[model samples]
Target: MRVGSTMLVRQNLTRKLSRSILLVICIGIAFFVFGVLSSFRAGFEGSEANSERLVVASKIGGNETLPLRYFQQLGGMDEIAEVTHVTRLRAHTAGNERNIIGANAVDAQSYASVYADTYDFNAEIMQAFQADRTATLVGRQLAEREGWAVGDRVNLTSFVHMTQDASRDWSFVIAGLLDGAEPTVDTNFLIVRYDYFNAALLRNQDQVNLFGIKPAVGTDINVLAETIDMTFANSTAQTRTQSETAFMSAFLEQFADVALIVKLIVSVSFGTILLIVANTMIFAIRERTLEIGVLKVLGFSGSSIMRIILTETLVLFAAGLALGFALTAAVIPVLGDALSSVVPDLYLTPKVVATSVGLAVVFAVLTGFLPAIKALRLPVATALNHR
Candidate 1:
């Protein structure tokens, strides 16, 4: 096998350097696209799967606000383990002038109790946030990016000006950091006490965008969701509730059908690779017609000829796969930073790497099969006389 590979490398790749190089480039690009899409989907679905939480939003739409009274009502339900409400604030930091980062005003004690399963709150920080209305807790990612430490004061410019004065900037003391329980949990939110926000921005008082719910274990989550919706049915402010996974799917569907988009992209990429690789293989075999005849005359079996061709095609794919995956690994961090709000996190996991290698093997078989068949059946005399 080693001797056969040496022969193929010398007579095929070395002699046809231009064709080989072009094929490698094309294969690299195709696989790179596949790796990116797979990583995005994995990050999104993985986060949703481990969470058993539910979200209660206004029936009117996502942007509509719900009354603060709903928090008490939701908490009163026996099926719910915990409930908390939060209002979204528009805020931007230095150097991110164009991007509107998400900040939330949450009830410090209640919010901590609800998210305890997914996040660990420092006891001292929690005490500070509850004790001082101006105190805030930063997500791990935001703290690392902004170089914020305990007791550091940070000011955020809000889009909504305060009613008391036309001031847009709000300042807070960093009391603590919210650390994620798992890698999939998003740690980019800047959570502040709602009392301070409501008192500061008197214009938008006693209103929250959504309620987060945690159901008691052994409780039927879907049934509880239906019950919550039914309780508020046709009221002045109707409510809609869904599991975390369902809500994420619905939210992502607003942009595009994720499954359909993935299918179209993978299909197009592989189709292009199939044509490019097949042409390269056929040309390489045709150029080596006389060499193949000599091999057969020297007692090489037809199966051995087929093995040589298949092995050569696989080597080309392996080279491209290595380059493509390395490129994907390098690009993941930049992509994650740019799309942090949407993607949350991007990773090139071992499962994804294994899947890409399996795809390369499949490509090898498809591209090399027809050419190998031709080489196997060629008459030694006829092949020797070819131009």
Candidate 2:
């Protein structure tokens, strides 16, 4: 019975080659969009899965700075594993804002120790940073984009705080380059010694932008964050502390309502595919009314007739989905640089692939149902008597 049903579906599909090809193309395009957008949403959240760190920033927005002394006090806490200070210089390359990269000043030893796994810290790189105060370590992505190498000198023009002389005067020698082992590590930052930046901004002693803290094993992060805030409650520099995941999530929230946006996009994309498939199925059924009646008259049950139509729809959708996934894989690599900065962690996971294919099948079955039922309800004598 199944064999006869399969043969019938193939004949109908071949009879209308143009319609079959068009529907397959539509399904493929829809699935491609689904694969890429879903990957982006997942990539954004994936960055927050690391369990060991926290970010301490100002409660109020803007260029509010914390006193450097807080770093010492925070490091002394029992629940804290280590603390590192990060100040965003907000500087650009020689007054070119287009060359905007993260310019951070941090303690070399502490920073390296805390993020050893993320950043490839070798003795040679460490030695260069230690020996020279004017040296900086850049991320691999930034280096490749700007065509920089070791021993190259890069000059940055300060944007946040300008010198009295109006001279944009800060420069660093490229001592090393670092790459993240995982996608979460934000490999677009530049690291320099805090003392170098602090010494240069001695007059503006109160300005330190952010603090990165590592929590001790088994410590409650929520409790520790509250404690850190309370410790500096009376001080002039008020602080807000959160786990690394929460910290990164807060920053992403500033861009857009990510969850809502992703939901809306997915809903709309699938809804479009549903309508397309339904319309196609309706047309297919209209064209095949005579054929369906002949099959029923030949002793095929309603269930078998339904199965044949559903199988045709499923096959068409599957072909399109496979083609779309292949196209996505081939295209993403060519846009590597553009995507690296925008969607740093974007990649097609096995789960995403499975979900996309599953959605295609589910939607095809759902949209094809009404047409299948309509064909199943046709009387053999009436269907055969029709033109």
Q: TM-scores of all models? A: 0.80, 0.84
Cα displacement (angstroms), candidate 1, residue 293, comes to: 5.0
Candidate 1 structure quality by residue, lDDT tens digits, 1-387? 767457765567667778777788788888788888888876655463434788898888777889999999999999999899988877886346665656899987778778887888768778878888888899887788678898898788777636347677778888888788776677777898898888888476898988889898888888999999999996899998988777767657767878578769988998999898998899889988998998899988878889888987888898889888988898988898877766776778677889999999999899999899999999999988988
Prediction 2 global C-alpha lDDT: 0.79
Query: How would you encode candidate 2's per-residue C-alpha lDDT over 10-98 as one tens digit per residue?
Result: 88788889988988888888877777777776666555345567788888742678888888888899998878888888877886777
List lDDT for all candidates, in order: 0.82, 0.79
Model 1 has an lDDT value of 0.82
The 10-residue segment of model 2 with minimum total lDDT is 42-51
Best by lDDT: 1
lDDT of 1 at 378: 95
Tally clashes: model 1.
0
Cα error, residue 204 of model 1, in Å, equals: 4.3
The list of candidate 2 runs beyond 4 A from truth reads 1-5, 39-52, 163-166, 183-186, 220-238, 258-262, 339-351, 373-386
